[model samples]
Target: MLLPFFEWCENTAIGETIRNSLWLFPVIEAVHLLALCLLGGSLLVVDLRMLGVGLKGQRISQVAGYARPFLIGSIVTLVCTGLLLFLSEAVKCYYNTSFWVKITTLPIALLLTFAVRDRFSLRKSFETSAMSRLLGAGSLTLWFVVAAAGRWIGFS
Candidate 1:
């Protein structure tokens, strides 16, 4: 069903231009990676805080709140660049297992990021700490899979 859309995307002018360009692809990929780093770093701080490590001076909620905008911004950047990257090679991605994996996990990661934030920060219950740790671990694991699969797309 979506194959036709992918075909259309690959044939689009933007995709053709990027795919044909020697330098544009690399430059855009670099920006995508930088956005990944920003996303990972911001997530790490909040996850680590939940894990009972790092920034002990600040509350977990504080760390999470601080990282929220970074998360949102980096996500936006990643999605834009990622869409360009995908548009350039939509057919290739359609056949790539790693791309499929990333696609599957990415939405879950996005939902978990915000849902966990709301649950972790807004709750006053004592179990919030344990719950935060659990959610943090899950978020980290899902994101790792997403990142690893994304990287694997280059190799596969």
Candidate 2:
């Protein structure tokens, strides 16, 4: 059932149109990389601030506020291109464990972002509280796992 849906997608006008474009895949992939960089970089900056590693003189909310746009932009770019890429190989990715792990971790990452961000906004200190710091560390670890799994998917 799903196979046909994916096949149909691959054969659809839009898919064919994108497939025919000479630089579409490369361009989208480059954008994806750029987005990943921005997301990781922005998050790290904020996390480091939380950990008292970066912007030590700055408030956590201030640092996070400044980085929010970059995070949002990266997420938008990443999701858009990621969907396109997934559609291009939907059936395969649908069954890939790494892809699933990546999917699963996304919510955790989002939750961490909201929780930490909200706390900071609520006048809470961000001086690397044990829980928040753990969350940050876990966030980084999970994302790394997601990327590693994504790479492994190609091999399998």
Candidate 3:
């Protein structure tokens, strides 16, 4: 079932164009990297705030508010570019272990960031709690692994 979908993705016009154009693939890959960096930076700011390390003296809500737009935008950009990159090499990715690791971790990390960490960050009571610290640390670790796994895909 999934094999057919992967095959279909590889046969799509955009996928074919990406694969055939030597420059297009590299350009998209670079965009994906830049988007990841933006995403990581934005999340790091919020996470560090949650951990009470950075932006000390500022309200958690205030710090998070500053990073929220960039975080959301980067997520959208990364997902779009990531999907395009995946389509360009669907078959190879289908068999890649690092690809699977990244795919699995990406959603988990996103959920930890947007659902768990963001919710806690918005509540003043939870801002300095142990739970907040744990969530902050976990989010950072998850995203770090996600980025590492993504790089490993190139090697594998």
Q: Is candidate 1 or candidate 2 better by lDDT?
A: 1
Candidate 3's C-alpha runs over 4 A off are: none
Candidate order by decreasing lDDT: 1, 3, 2
Candidate 3 residue-wise lDDT, 1-156, digit = tens: 688889999999999999999899899989988988899888888788778888878888788888889999988998999999999999998889999999999999988888777787777665666876887889889998999999999999
Error of 2 at 24 (Å): 1.1
Question: In order, what is each prediction's RMSD in angstroms?
Answer: 1.7, 2.5, 1.2
Give each model a TM-score. 0.93, 0.82, 0.94
Show the colliding residue pairs in model 2.
none
Off by over 4 Å in 1: 122-128
What Cα-based lDDT does every candidate model obtain?
0.87, 0.74, 0.87
TM-score of 2: 0.82
If both were scored by TM-score, which would come out higher, candidate 1 or candidate 3? 3
Global CA lDDT computed for model 2: 0.74
- Encode model 1's per-residue lDDT on 29-144: one tens digit a residue: 99999999999999898888777787766777777778888988999999999999999999999999999999999999988877655566535332336777887788889999
